[model samples]
Target: DASRIAIRHGLPNSAALPIAQHKDYDRMFADIRDKLHAKSGDPVKPEHLE
Candidate 1:
């Protein structure tokens, strides 16, 4: 999960997904954040992001 976030943020790819880069990492995170927010809890913000 942690690596996914980074890979999806142009930070670094994990040993899980075969992502070579975070082309649309920000957008990916946005979509996920929206979906999660719609369900419950607050949207995932990068302020306190690791």
Candidate 2:
């Protein structure tokens, strides 16, 4: 998904995105993980997912 964002924004690669953008991507991933965890009723913490 980060790669897709990079490509969509014409970045050379995912690493080329700015730090803020990188964090945004990370947060997006975390949110998705949270949703999945919620559905499965897992007890894992968000920070552990990172």
Q: Against the hidden reference, what TM-scores do the models get?
A: 0.30, 0.35
| lDDT tens digits by residue: candidate 2, 1-50 | 87778678876773564764777877886787777665344576767657
lDDT at position 8, candidate 1: 82
Best by lDDT: 2
For every model shown, the clashing-pair count is 0, 0
Candidate number of the best TM-score: 2
lDDT of 1 by residue, 9-49 (tens): 88755554555355687577667777556433565666545
Q: How far off is residue 33 in model 2, in Å?
A: 0.1
lDDT of 2 at 18: 73
User: Where does model 1 exceed 4 Å of error?
Assistant: 1-23, 38-50
Ten-residue stretch with the least lDDT total in model 1: 12-21
Query: Would you list the C-alpha lDDT of every candidate in the order shown?
Result: 0.63, 0.68
Q: For model 1, what is the C-alpha lDDT against the true structure?
A: 0.63
RMSD of each: 10.9, 9.6
Off by over 4 Å in 2: 1-21, 38-50
